[model samples]
Target: MSIQVGDTLPDVEIRVVSNGIEEGRTGPLFAGRKVVLFAVPGAFTPTCSNRHLPGYVQHLAQFQARGVEVMCLAVNDAYVMQAWAASQNVPPELLMLADGNGNFTKAMGLELDGNAYGMGLRARRFALYAENGVVKALQVEAPGEFRVSTAEAILEALA
Candidate 1:
């Protein structure tokens, strides 16, 4: 089942780049804070790179205006995620995390198989509004869909 609204987010390990060095961070970054967590299937994928990510990039100011901290999570490594963020010009304020090995994605129950495309476990496209480490709004897609989970949708929910 998907992580529903009001579910307490699981504690998962994250890789963080500090001064060009990669280190693992545990516990939850969203603890005691409001966050907009988004998951995508893969990095550099069509819809993901094009519409999904850009929507967040474009409306980041609006999200922040409402006191929301937006974060993007993927089942990719820290290196790839950092590169993708740079390539897409995502702002520094937004948290783009790498959930490598699917530990966090699996914990959120949003894991998907992209073996046909040579990609293993990945996260489905979705978005959640979390406050103080607990979910307040949830939007898991309908498998091949990507409408409501966009940043604009999350912004609407936040508003």
Candidate 2:
């Protein structure tokens, strides 16, 4: 089943580009903190680069002002994530996570099959809010749609 409100985030290894691709678990990242994690189907894709990620980048301070750490996750590797971040001019505080191998995506039951697109396994476009390791809200988009998972939408939901 897909993760829902009140579910504790699954423990899984994720990679982040810190001093050259440091690895860590999902547990401590959400433990004792409020987090807004949004995933894209792929990095550098048209919609993701133009709308999804840039929305978060534009409104990052609003989320931070609400005491939430914003994260952008994709199934790509840390190197790609780092390059994307640099290309987008992402702020240092906004984390870029690499869910390589789709472990975390599968654990959350949010994996998207993109074999037809020649993309292989990828993450569905979605966003979630969590506090102290427990999910509070989740917004998943319909296939080929981008509605409820936007930064503005998530902030409005939090409000």
> Which portions of model 1 miss their true places by more than 4 Å?
17-26
Instruction: Give the range where candidate 1 is weakest over 10 consecutive residues by summed lDDT.
Output: 17-26
Q: Distance from true position, residue 10, model 2, in Å?
A: 0.5
lDDT of 1 by residue, 76-152 (tens): 88888888888899878877888888888888888898898788899988999888888898888888898889988
- In Å, residue 45's CA in model 2 sits off its true spot by 0.4
How does each model score on lDDT? 0.83, 0.94
Candidate 2, residues 36-153, lDDT tens digits: the string is 9999999999999999999999999999999999999999999999999989989888899899899999999999999999999999999999999899999999999999999999
Clashes of 2: 0
> Which pairs clash (backbone N, Cα, C closer than 3 Å) in model 2?
none
Which TM-score value belongs to model 2?
Answer: 0.97
Q: Each candidate: RMSD to true structure?
A: 1.8, 0.9
Residue 51 error, candidate 2, Å: 0.4
